[model samples]
Target: MLAVNYTTLRENMKTYMDKITDDYETVIVTRKDNKNVVMLSEEAYNNIMENIHVLGNKSNYDWLMESKAQLENGMASAHELSEAETDE
Candidate 1:
């Protein structure tokens, strides 16, 4: 990990470019106050995005977790919701 101020990044853009190699992961550019931008390689970006699926649906999450555990233990059972009647 490298912390570089925006001015330094702007001044040494070429040096920063040269520093990027296959071994390097990311280059973070920040202000003196530590506000920053993340620079990542395409392969790194793709790998990060690929693992983003771990962040799944927030709704019904607790239900899912409990049901998942139950299913794994062969104790899961389903209850069908009653259908609502519609009048014309």
Candidate 2:
């Protein structure tokens, strides 16, 4: 995470934007009156939204927890994928 004032961010917009996209960094742009904004890559934003959607659903969250518990308890099985499946 990086924090910079609005003037500094504007001065080096390309540098900061490149860093954010290349390194998957989150940047906070500070402003007056306690108004601030965050900058992140589109890929990062999508991943965050996807996680929120998955975890926000009660049934999906419960299913994931159950799967995790089964894996932790060694109740999971492993199977090799066939070549046809892998091709897809």
Candidate 3:
């Protein structure tokens, strides 16, 4: 994540665009009136939206919470990823 003033971002829009797209970074543009905004890669935005969709559902949220509880209580198994599997 990178923070930049609105004026600075306005002056170097292309540079910031390249950073956000090529580097997959999130940019925080600060406003004078404190209305800050974020600029993220399209893939990042899509992933966030998908997560919101999943967590917004009652059943999905309940299942996720249950899974988290199980993991925290030592009821879940952790596995090490092999090199081939890690590539994905």
lDDT of each: 0.73, 0.97, 0.95
TM-score of predicted model 1? Answer: 0.49
Ranking by TM-score: 2, 3, 1
User: Each prediction's TM-score against the native?
Assistant: 0.49, 0.87, 0.68
Clashing pairs in 3: none
Model 1 lDDT tens row, 1-88: 6767888889997777656556564789986666678877777777787656443555556667787898999996789999999998
lDDT ranking of the models: 2, 3, 1
- Candidate 2: tens digits of C-alpha lDDT, residues 1-88: 9999999999999999999999999999999998999999999999999999999999999999999999999999989987655554
* Lowest-sum lDDT 10-residue window in model 3: 79-88
Off by over 4 Å in 1: 54-88
lDDT tens readout by residue for model 3, 1-88? 9999999999999999999999998999999789999999898899999999999999999999999999899998768987655555
Root-mean-square deviation of candidate 2? 2.8
lDDT score for residue 30 of model 2: 98
lDDT of 3 at 25: 88
Better model by TM-score: candidate 2 vs candidate 3: 2
